[model samples]
Target: MAPPVLVLCRLAPDTLAEFADRFRLLDFYASALPIHAFLAAVAADGDPPRVVLVFGGAPIRVGAELLDAVPSLRCIITISAGLNHIDLTECARRGVQVANAGGIYSADVADYAVGLLFDVLRHVSAGNRYVRRGLWTERGDFVPLGSRIGGKRVGIIGLGNIGSAVARRLEAFGCVVSYHSRRRKEDVPYAYFPSARELAASSDVLVVACALTAETRHIVDRGVLDALGERGVVVNVARGANVDEAELVRALADGRVAGAGLEVFENEPNMPPELMAMDNVVLTPHQAVFTPESMADMRRVVVANLEAFFAGEPLLTLVE
Candidate 1:
């Protein structure tokens, strides 16, 4: 008999078919009953699932309470790279091994971050609007000048897999890169700043690529934005909570900061209406890691982790 596994979020049909082949999947998402009632019924069954599969999204939050409902759960496999949605501490306390998508999406996400930065610096999106609206034909060929990307000082937060990839790409474009991480890395050639403010003060553009944790929540606050100055740009590929949304809006509105490129926001699927009207801001719908190639890689990583867990082998991407 196949081992029992609980699925909490909606997955692609192909991915679901693959899981069904290897495990006995108890899908909470497909149940007609409310999730709480379904969980209660499962708990009463007393043969709790040994593993749970989840995705990184707002709807499914795995905390102590959820963990308590599945006392037999020994492993959690998430298809997303960010672990902000999972309660790592509680999982640790309960000896639940956690696995993530690892660096499979690093290259794709890094490429998107650089793309956003270029769009902001060169007014690519705004230029598209100008051309489409016939502003160029109506008002002659004059358009607002954009800053050059070459020789710009770039400061990156987190310096992890994605951040390091971003640095390498920027370097190829003749951009100087520095970074701020929890601690200084001994292997990297780039300069390391002790704090985000110091890094922002010296950088022409600030790129946020850190993970979201209690220590990192709102890490890029008003002070950091101010340090970037009136002529500086901010690009965030990390979690939206990493920057204070209200402070960022105020900074852009008052012209305290030059511009922004955002792929994430404090609220998913919703953003401040003021940003919609700004030509200097470039926004994407959290698609930094949505490439088809990356999606395939993610599926492989997730399956690998689950296979490893069931085989009693070391997980491919264990969160430690």
Candidate 2:
């Protein structure tokens, strides 16, 4: 009998069907796995399957535990960009091949990032709120408004696929784009800054698109915020742990930075109380890659990953 493939994250019908047709798919699972508490069912079933595919947004904690549970597991496929949810060390130790979909959702996230930029900078959301509250009728009195994104300085941290996508989108809006990465990428046309602080200081909008690793955990700290000053706005589509939650709250609270558009938080589903109270900021529940197009694309790639594995071919989009 072929080795069983355990699928997690409850993929869409087509992706599920495609995977099913390609592999010896195991027949137990459900939707809505709480990411942080993903291990709530760590090893609930009988024997662990040989090939495990995690399509959900759960963290590496669950992945680590799965390695322990599924001693026979030889491969893991994560359907998202961030592998922080997958335990790399344990995978290496056990010789489990791991793969991820880093570039799959880049465009969607970049569009969302720029959307937040325009909304916050142009007061688009606030303007809608203005009319909803019947304030537009008494519009003779002027509300303080800001300038357009046109020609505004945009600073991007992490010049990866998403960052480059953001740069291209922002550039079309007539915004000047500069980026800072650990090692500068030579292919992109944007100007490069050596440090986050320098980029934050130089741009009107500083966006965090870098990965969340030891080198970048809370890289967007108080010093970086201080450098950004009161006129600059911040946008983070990357993992929330990239910024110090307390410092970000304080920054927006005291006008250290003008505003922020945050889609991810340090502790999701439990936002800081201060964030809810702020009108200048826009928050999303980790929905940067939640668009229909992106969702469809994500599903397609995930199925392909599983298909490739079952075919005894190299995995698509493997994580280094």
Best by TM-score: 1
Candidate 1 Cα outliers beyond 4 Å, as residue runs: 44-47
Instruction: Judge candidate 1 at residue 236 and give its lDDT.
Output: 95
- Kindly state the number of residue pairs that clash in model 2: 2
Where does model 2 exceed 4 Å of error? 1-3, 10-18, 21-48, 59-64, 138-142
Q: Positional deviation of 263 in candidate 1, in angstroms? A: 0.4
Q: Write the per-residue lDDT of candidate 2 for residues 118-225, one digit (tens) a residue.
A: 888877777787888888887753366855889989999998989999999988889999999999888878888888998888888999999888999998999999
- Global CA lDDT of candidate 1, please? 0.90
- Candidate 2 yields a Cα-based lDDT of 0.80
The estimated TM-scores of all candidates read: 0.96, 0.88
**Could you tell me how far off, in angstroms, the CA of residue 149 lies in candidate 2 after the best superposition?**
0.7
Error of 2 at 276 (Å): 1.6
Cα lDDT tens digits for candidate 1, 1-320: 78778888788788789889988888887788677777766666546687788887734588887877767788988888899989999999999999988999899999999999999999999999998999998987736788899999999999999999999999999999999999999999999999999999999999999999998899999999999999999999999999998999999999999999999999888999999999999989998888779878877887788889989999999999
Give the Cα lDDT of each candidate.
Answer: 0.90, 0.80
